[model samples]
Target: MCISNPNSISDQTDLVAMKARLWALLRKEEHEWLQKSRLKWFKEGDINMKFFHLTASSRAKRNQISKLKEIPVKRLSVGSRRLLERLFSEEEVWNMSCRLCLIEDSSFNNSFISLIPKIDEAVSPEDYRPLSLVGSLNKIVSRVMARRMASCLKEVVGENQFAFIVGKQIVDCVLIANEVIDDLSKKKKKL
Candidate 1:
């Protein structure tokens, strides 16, 4: 007579449910191998808090172990001087967008001052004013150009890159445009 393990069916079902839940939870932020390895580790009872903490620390020390492999090629550096330089080049490429928008130098200056208020306050007024203007205008122009560049970029880099660029550009443009619009509205109110 052959005897079946009484717990086998229930164990399998529980495992499936646990895997589904983990996958659902980490779907947005997990790479394929990380997901698979995590599920396997979990089945082996290696993902409890103490074990997980140790694993995470060990993983962090390793050079090639990435939880999310789909991270962008370019690091998103905020307020870097190199970022400013890239913005400058982006603006030059989007000269047509600037021409179409008719954004003035003075308005650009004011916008830049408002955009990076922390940075502006740190610098002397004379030095800050010109730098702020150029930075702000470049940002605005880059944004406008980004929209036009999206289709071309999408063709080359695929949808994700295009989406990322367009999303950032839209946010930047909307912020500047809203500020300008609000000022105009206030002026009209005074008049």
Candidate 2:
């Protein structure tokens, strides 16, 4: 059992105690008594912690988000009523083409809001941070849509962009910028 996760309660103890326990188990000569126990057929042996760590469990952590960094927010919650009224009344803007916007699952939005701290515990529906509870069907659909859209979006996007574009890294972007600056400086010096 301890072979699976060494950091478990039993494995975290001193080595001396474990060795003594193993030694006692080994010294025992009786066999009939083992038949009554749950692990009757199990063979005990030396544990290799390194071997166990090679594969990880697929389970998510118990209601915990690891290593959350501050995420930036844009636009205030609501604009002035006068501004909204003016926009609504504008004939030029209204006559132009219209596009629809969408809101993803509540869970998806709550996942972000929950990361931020609040002065009081969540009591009302608004206070509660939601977890994504979308069905498996929706998850599959989302994945397919993402794959299909990736190629289409790629053609229009610049090579330098990394934000929200799957697998791109800020570190790579910064490194490229540094290299360009260095090369430009070298050329300027030569001139």
| Best-fitting candidate, scored by lDDT | 1
- Model 1 segments beyond 4 Å from truth? 1-136, 157-191
lDDT of 2 by residue, 35-137 (tens): 5453432322125444334322323344457778886533322333233333233443222212112234544322222333243875667665555555433
Residue 169, candidate 2: Cα error in Å is 3.1
The TM-scores of all predictions, comma-separated, are 0.22, 0.27
lDDT of 1 by residue, 82-158 (tens): 34444445555567545656545656534433333346346555443243445555666666556545434433454
RMSD values for the candidates in order, in angstroms, are 22.1, 21.9
Candidate 1, residue 63: CA error in Å?
8.1
TM-score, candidate 1, is 0.22
